[model samples]
Target chain A: MKAVEVKHLYFRYSREWILEDVSLELEDKEFLAIIGPNGGGKTTFLRILLGFLKPTKGEVKIYNKPPNKASYLIGYVPQYTTFSTDIPIVVEDIVLQGRLRKGKFFYTKEDKKIAYEKMEILGILHLKDKKIKNLSGGERQKVLIARALSVEPKILIMDEPTSAIDIKGQNEILNLIESLELTRIVVSHDVKILFRKVDKIAYINKRAIIHEAPQLNIPKDRHFCEVELIDFLKGEECGI
Target chain B: MWDLINTSIYAGILLSIAIGIIGSLIVVNKATSITGSIAHGSFGGIGIGLYLGVSVIVSTLFFTILLAIVLGVVSLYFQDRKDSLIGVIWALGMSVGIIFLNLTSGYQADALSYLFGNILLVGDSDLKFMAITDLVLIFSIVFLYNRFLAMSYDIEFLRLRGINVSLLYFYFLILTSITIVMSVRAIGIILILALFTIPPLIAEKFTKKFYQTIILSSIIAFIFIASGILISYYYDLSPTPIIVLIASFGLFLSMLKRS
Candidate 1:
């Protein structure tokens, strides 16, 4: 089943055309990366898909329903820096935000168990009591990912998951998302950030350029703009 | 100084804490200035209540919510530009209040207590109302703490997860209105705006997270009220302004130190 669908979507933020005639779709369990330069409407595209942005023209559907209605089925971990970490929240509480899909503040026993299980999976169960401000960047990202996963949505979308983190944190997050079982669509300028894990790359500068199963055996010399190709990367690790 | 610190001063101290806690929450939630507008606009409710010969507290409770929700919804509807619109409502509300105060027969200046708060003058009934409002604020936050946090930190993420962020946003406005209505006594109509703003402004100097900001600001508010109560009682000054000014001073000092 296709988890995300956008057709002729056009969005303008106060006179700036962010997404123009952008249409794309992803089947269930597909890992897609949206690569673009800064301000190329990557965030805007994510917002439109999440129904946070109203397109001036076109339609967006997630899980067979309209974006807004179908949003509950979508999990999101927006850029971690968007929120201040100095909040006194614990990892457990942060993760619980993911369970928002369940639609209640007070969690049931089963909910509590599930939250803890997610925490354990993220390897931060022991940090449940620590304040968010005290955590390292990588740990914070993990906690955020755990929170997004708490809803157990079929489709997970992240915006710039590896942008500001150190190399180790970047690798951890890249590996973590790669290991996840859900369908994933991540946006990043760092092409190689998700290349190791993602099955395909949708090169988006102004428009999306799709590349199928870019494994090591693929003959990249055959297609794509020369300048668009990176210095060196092969197979699933596409132009790294 | 020792003799000035009496029983009433002690009561002032406790109320001051309440001020800071509420102030901090207001700042973190970006409801400070809006709450200020609501506090000022509430005079309209106070005026209508007085004119109608109804219980002022009841009127305030009802009107604040209606008005605050209106303010919240208006801002949210306008995509959070209700600040300018709220300014219009504030001025209009005050104008209406002044007109009603003048036209009403019994008490023209009797509404002075609401204009500039008298913390030392907070009666038992006012205290009771404050207590209830405090409890509600605490309860709502405790119950929906995670929801509120998620909404505050990452509203889009919450919306994506289908958390109904809009409803929660309104829920915050409702709680803010109720808090404003309750604390109308200590902060007065004029200085209540400060009580909703200054302490949090100061607290943010020391704390990063929303809850810490609330705690620190509450502590500061408590101190200011306690000191203001003593100073007001001895020097015969208006306690609300004094307390709010103290908080302002604290905020200034904190900012200075950070700078």
Candidate 2:
């Protein structure tokens, strides 16, 4: 079964359509990157996929189930900017929140063991007891990733995972994302991800155009910038 | 003097439980404005209760919860108009209360007590009610701890995790409204925000975890209230202002230390 299937999805906030008739599919374990200009409906598309916002029209199914039903199978890493660093929560608690499901009140010892395992994977086990306010931006991003990973999700979804980090931190996050083996969907504006062996690219701007990995004409072993990528995406031969 | 001290201590302990738990959430969730609005708006309930010759607690509980529900609905559904609407509700509730007090016959000494607080007037029945409120607050927090913690920063994450964010939020507001009403006699509406927010703010500085913050805030709030009561007894002053002043001083010192 496909990891995700979006059939003619449409969404709107007020009157004008934020997303219109967008459709795409991802095979199991497929890696997809969604890129678009600000307010170009990239986030909206992700929101609909995550079931935060229902599509105004059309259907979205994750592994043949609705987004809400398949929520347990999906791990989400929100944009770094969306969180307030001033919260007095420890890293362990934040990661443990990933284990939350219906009818479960307290975290069991087994849950703690899994949380530690995910933190260990993210190399943030040493930072478990530290407060979120005390962590660097990159460290905080890693915590969020660890929290998402703790869910043991079939699909890992991230929104602008490295947007707030420095260049070195961004590279670390990219490498980490590269190492993760899951059906991953990342919403990002960073062009470096294009070269990171992503399986496909979904360019969304009021409408969505899917480009399979083979269709991307990126030159290997040469540095590429965002403006150039946008130009390439807009080029008619690339099939916008 | 000993009986007054004992009563004030009991009130302080009960108030601290709420201050520590709900106050921590209030500060972390950035709900202080909404909490303040609910608190001040509860005056309308008190006034209506006095005017109708009903139990003030019952009237305030009904009024504040109704006001909080409306506030919660607006906050959840209307994103753009939240702040302006909160201001409107705050002023409207206070206005209604003042009008009701004006329309009532004779002197309205009860209005002063509700507005500014008179902890000395707390009776055995008041303590019983406060104990019940504390139980409700504790039970709700214990059961909803994980979700409420997540809701502090990321309601979307909780919603994605299959938690009903709106319903949880409504429940939180209702609990908050009840806690605020219960606290009115001990701290009054005007000063309640201080007791609800300042200790949590101070405790956040010294703690690394949310539960730690709540625990420390409860202890700190008790200290402030106890100290305020003792000082007020010696100086023959109102305990509410004394308590708030001490808490504020602690906050200032905390900020100074941090800076």
Give the winner by DockQ: 2
Assess each model's interface with DockQ, reporting 2 decimals per model. 0.42, 0.80
| lDDT by candidate, in order shown | 0.73, 0.89
Predicted candidate 1 versus true structure: per-residue lDDT over A103-205, tens digit per residue:
4667677777878988898889998887787888888888888877888888898988887899987888888888988989898878565347567666655
With candidate 1 superimposed using the best TM-score fit, by how many Å does residue B177's alpha carbon deviate from the native?
1.9
Against the correct fold, how does model 1 do in TM-score?
Answer: 0.81
Error of 2 at A239 (Å): 4.3
True-vs-predicted CA distance for residue A171, candidate 1, Å: 2.7
What are the clashing pairs of model 1? A86-B209, A87-B209, A215-A235, A216-A235, B16-B221, B16-B222, B17-B222, B20-B218, B21-B218, B117-B188
Stretches off by above 4 angstroms in model 1 are A7-21, A54-59, A101-103, A108-127, A205-207, A215-226, A230-240, B1-21, B50-55, B80-83, B102-107, B197-220, B245-259
Tell me the deviation in Å of residue B89 in model 2.
0.7
Model 2 in CAPRI terms: which quality?
high
lDDT of 2 at B65: 95
Off by over 4 Å in 2: A223-226, A236-240
Q: Candidate 2: lDDT of A182?
A: 92
